[model samples]
Target: MIGYVTIGTNDIEKSKAFWCDLLEELGASVVMDAGRIAFIGNGSEKAMLAVCTPYDENAPHPGNGAMVAIDPGSKEMVEKLYARALELGATSDGEPGQRIPDMFYGAYFKDPDGNKACFYQFA
Candidate 1:
């Protein structure tokens, strides 16, 4: 019962480049673009990820304790994407590893705009 998740950015173009390049690994592309806002994903049937400028026109900031979690289908993918995010200028929040005993493997990072995200897989 989930639709899409929106992340605020002060630099829409930079965020777009970062997200589009990173998400392309999963075959997600810019399905919609409205100048100040853009949506990236496979299609409407799957949850989409959107990056947008704040409607209020003030500087955008990441919300405390909010995060977007993505399942990239495997532990290897998590590791690969986590490293890729860092290479794309994301700062590390957590390294790729099993978060729960033989159950959840994940990696975490904060995008250039400070939006938190996770890539994970269930083992």
Candidate 2:
């Protein structure tokens, strides 16, 4: 029941670089680039990720505990995405591993803007 998510950004270009490079690997691309750019997943325009400077013109601040949970499609994909995020300068919130054995497998990290995020698979 989710359509899209918008992450606040103070520097649009920096945030654009982050999301573009990252989401493009997951099959999304820049579909909207007006005031706020949004990356829409291939074959689904309804679900998108966007970055925008606050309308009030204040510095963008990441909300604590808010995250965009991603599904990279497999355990291997999860591992790869987690590692790639770190390589691109994202801080680790938690390393790649099982959060609950035989149940929930998860990995966590903070994006460049310090937004908490994760990808997981059912084990």
Candidate 3:
């Protein structure tokens, strides 16, 4: 398992806004914002998201097939985060709903740079 993920974005400000909004919707707070990088989570003592500027415009966007799944605590929380992602300009991959019936409920969305991310609650 990975400890953290740092994604490179062409527009730092836009990326920051999108992620900050999404995290807030998931009940997490922005813990750090040092111009080029922004970290969001419960607090500075436990940052979970790290957003960084792309080294080059030609850098490839993260693929849709590679998704970062967030555990939003509950099905309702996942739904809320999914809605917030869409509200902030993310394109929908799927609507929030139950999946694998007995196992999960979630939704998927794509970030501006085409990175795929999802929020899910597992049973």
Model number with the top lDDT: 1
Clash statistics: count for each candidate: 0, 0, 0
Worst ten-residue run, lDDT, model 1? 37-46
TM-score of 3: 0.83
lDDT of 2 by residue, 1-123 (tens): 777888887677787777777766787777777765545455444677778888788887888778888888889989998888888878999888988989888889887887788888887
The true-versus-predicted C-alpha distance at residue 61 of model 2, in Å, is 1.4
Off by over 4 Å in 3: 44-47, 56-60
Clashing residue pairs, backbone N/CA/C < 3 A, model 2: none
Model 3 alpha-carbon miss at residue 7, Å: 1.6
Compute the lDDT of residue 114 as modeled in candidate 1. 93
Residue by residue across 13-118, what tens digits does model 3's lDDT show?
Answer: 8888888878875567667788877777776555377777755646657854677888979988888888888888999999988889889888999888778888
Q: Who wins the TM-score comparison?
A: 1
* lDDT pick, better of 1 and 2: 1
TM-score of each: 0.97, 0.89, 0.83
Global lDDT of each model? 0.94, 0.79, 0.79
The regions of model 2 sitting more than 4 angstroms off are none
- Give the per-residue lDDT of model 1 (tens digit) for 1-123: 888999999899999899988989999988889999999999878899999999999999898999999999988899999999999999999999989999999999999999999999999
Cα-lDDT of candidate 3 = 0.79
